[model samples]
Target: MDIRQRLATNLRRLRLEKGWSQEEFADQAGIHRTYVSDIERGARNPTITVVERLARPLGMSPSELLA
Candidate 1:
């Protein structure tokens, strides 16, 4: 899969592993729920800063998310 798809898949897997719904994950990630949904759907191209924001609560690096 492409990088965006990889990111989406990894993000969803990690979030589910943490037992956090999109809204809960978004709250922890300090972003909007819809933004989390967009990322999980591979429908958004988030910035590096945003990726960092996403990675933090998941105990991951941005590269890990993209990997």
Candidate 2:
């Protein structure tokens, strides 16, 4: 999968693994819920800073999240 697809899959997996709703995950990640939805749908090209924000609450690095 490409990076967008990778991010969507990984983000969904991570969020579900944490038993968090998109809204809940977004709140934790300090981003808007719609942004989380867009990311999960592979429709958003999040910036590195946004990736870092998403990663931090998940206890992972941005690179790891991309991986």
Query: Best TM-score goes to which candidate?
Result: 2
> Ten residues in a row with the worst lDDT in model 1?
58-67
Top candidate by lDDT:
2
- What are the lDDT scores of the predictions, listed in order? 0.93, 0.94
lDDT (tens digit, per residue) of candidate 2 on 1-67 = 8998998899999999999999999999889999999999999999999999999989999999999
TM for candidate 1 is: 0.95
Query: Lowest-lDDT window of 10 residues in candidate 2?
Result: 1-10
Residue pairs with clashing backbones, model 1: none
Model 2 alpha-carbon drift over 4 Å, by segment: none
Cα lDDT, model 1, residue 53: 98
Taking all chains together, each candidate's TM-score versus the true structure is: 0.95, 0.97
Candidate 1 deviates by what RMSD? 0.7
